[model samples]
Target: MQPNQHLRILTISSMLMLVLSIYMVFVYAPLEIVMGAVQRVFYYHVASGWIGALAFLITLICSILYLATRNLKWDHVALSSVEIGVVFTSMNIVSGSVWARPIWNTWWTWDPRLTTATIMWLLYAAYLMLRQSLENPQRRRTFAAVYGIVAFVSVPLTFAAIRIWRTIHPVIIGSSDPSAEGNFEMTPPMRNAFFFSLFTFTFLYVTLLWHRIRLEQLTVQVAAMQSRLLNKLST
Candidate 1:
């Protein structure tokens, strides 16, 4: 089978999975007793967070691969991972903000999770810009790989720092009860929706990453062909 055909199948499957997840979230999931309709946003919010976390992890791995092999394909994979990571990270923040508005009584806050996510977004943005500044492809890849690996060190630190800070300065409401912060007890239907959302988003992530890497490959091929054409014309 052709490579493009395989990609097409994956793409279709991802779309179908997303559609199914939406159905499960809206129709099948039970309403929360506490937050009502707004609580539904948590499914997508958490899914985005999960994908973002996975993306950064993949970025770290691909960065190591690029450094070891000096292969441009690894660089492509790293770039694709960062780009997709940024997309999901943004989604996570936005959805979280929406969920917080009704529950937290504010659109934004310096809560641990919110602050950590913001910092992560900025770190990846810097990585993307770093890639743009260099003229040489090899140097660009090398620097980006280094940055990808190094930037990830902050992820763990950010999480730990947030947890520590929250402990020192806890939320007044339900601060005593750990569950009060995001503590909606899930009914069986809610649990099904939550798990289904996670499953669907994971499939979507794989599907997007595959297509993005293929596009990068095609781009390299096109550039090589164009360069060859130019050389022949000049001769």
Candidate 2:
């Protein structure tokens, strides 16, 4: 199949899955006895958070490969992952804040999980800015790769912050601290919807990443063509 055809299929599938996920969340999933309708946000919120972490992991792997091989393609992959990570992480943070308002009685808090998450987001944002500041392509790739690897350290720290330290943030899957404010048990249908949301978001992430990589490849091709044209004109 042609590239455009493949992309079209992916686009259609992603949209369908997304629509199904939304219906599952609002319609299929049962209302929480305590949190009521707001509890539904947890599905996509956690899914986005997972995708954010997954994106950082991909960045770290690409950064490693770039450093070892000195391949600019890997740098492109790393940059793309960081860009996606930032988008998903921003979604996670905003959705968490929205979910927290009614449950925690405040839109913001300095809890360990929240604090580390904010720091993680800033770290990746700085990664993009660092690339922007550098003029030399080699220097930009090297520095960005190193920074990307180092920045991923924050991902694990952010995830473990809630598990290791006391926090008001609720733990959904595992044993949470007794003092956690918004923890709740999931019913069978909620569980199904939750897992399906995860699957849907993961599929979406792969689709987006594929397109981003293709865009990067096109960008490199364009730059090369421009350089060759300039050289010919000068000759």
Candidate 3:
């Protein structure tokens, strides 16, 4: 099959799975006796956070490859991944705040997990800004690759914050600290729904990353064309 055919299949599959995941979250999964309806957000909340970390991991790998081979394509992939990573990280943070409002008695806190996550978001946001502010394309790409590599330090730090520090954030799949707030046991149905959401979000990420990389490629081609046209006019 052709490449477009693959993308088409993925797009359709992602859409269907997303709808099914929503159903599983709301209807299939049993509600938490404690948190009530608000517990439903946990399905997508952890899923988006997984994607945020996954995207940055991909960026880290691509950035390393770009540095090793000096290939522009790796730089493109790194940049595209960062763009997607930032958006999903935003979703993760917002959703977490939404879930926290009632449980934590406030919308935000200075908990270790939350603090590291916010810092990670800001670091990548700065990466995007740095790329756009540079005048030279090659310099921007090279510098961004280096920055992407270094910024990934925040990803692991954010992930480990709850585990390593005294924080109020609950670790969903693992043991939570005694002070952790909003902790609850996952029913079998909740596990199925939560895992399915993770799979669906991953599928959605692949689809979005493909489209974003294609757009970046097209932008580069258009810039090349414009440069050639300007040269011809000068002659």
Candidate 4:
């Protein structure tokens, strides 16, 4: 099969899984006794958070590969991953705020998980901005690789925040701390839906990453062509 055909298949699979996941969240899963309808947000919320972290993890690995091999392909992958990670992290944070308004009585809090997540988003966002400020392409990619590796400290830190510090954030999967708010047990159907949503988001991430890598490659080609044209015009 052609590359586009393969991408199409993956994209279609992601869309179908996304539709099914929505049905599961709204129609299949049981409603929480406490939060009522708002609890449904938990499905996508957790999935987005998972994708966000997963994307950053990819960037870290690619960054390492780029530094070791000095391959521009790895740098391309790292940049694409960071861009996707930022969007998903933004979704995670926004969805959390929407869910929290009713449960926590406020839209924002200084909870450890929340704080770390915000910081993680900002770090990656700054990474993108850092690329723009640097004029030397080689210097930019090298710096970005180093920064991407260092910034990944936040991924583990954010993940462990709820576990280590006193926080209102709930760990829905494992045992929850007594101090944690919005804790709930998942029924069989809810678990199915939750896992399915995670699978769907992973699929979506793969599809998006493929598209992004292609776009980045095309961009590099265009920029090179423009530079060539400029030199010819100057001569």
The lDDT values for all models are 0.82, 0.93, 0.93, 0.95
What lDDT is obtained when candidate 2 is compared to the true structure? 0.93
TM-score of each: 0.90, 0.96, 0.98, 0.97
TM-score of 2: 0.96
Please give, for residues 1-235, the per-residue lDDT of candidate 1 as tens digits.
Answer: 1468777888898899899899999999987887789888888887887788889989999999999999888889889988998999899889878877777778888866677778999999899999889988889899999999999976776555444554322232233334335566678888888889989988899989988898888888998999999999999
Question: Clashing residue pairs in candidate 4, if any?
Answer: none
Please write out the lDDT profile of model 3 over residues 1-235, one tens digit for every residue. 1258777888999999999999999899998999899999888889999999999999999999998999988998999999999999999999999999999999999999999999999999999999999999879988999999999999999999999999999988889999999999998999999999999999999999998888898899999999999999999
Model 4 weakest 10-residue run by lDDT: 1-10
Best by lDDT: 4
Once fitted onto the true fold, the runs of candidate 4 whose alpha carbons sit more than 4 angstroms away are: 1-3
The clash numbers for all candidates, in the given order, read 0, 0, 0, 0
Candidate 3: residue 201 lDDT (0-100): 99
Query: How would you encode candidate 2's per-residue C-alpha lDDT over 78-145 as one tens digit per residue?
Result: 99889998999999999999999999999999999999999999999999999989998889999999
lDDT minimum window of 10 residues, candidate 3: 1-10
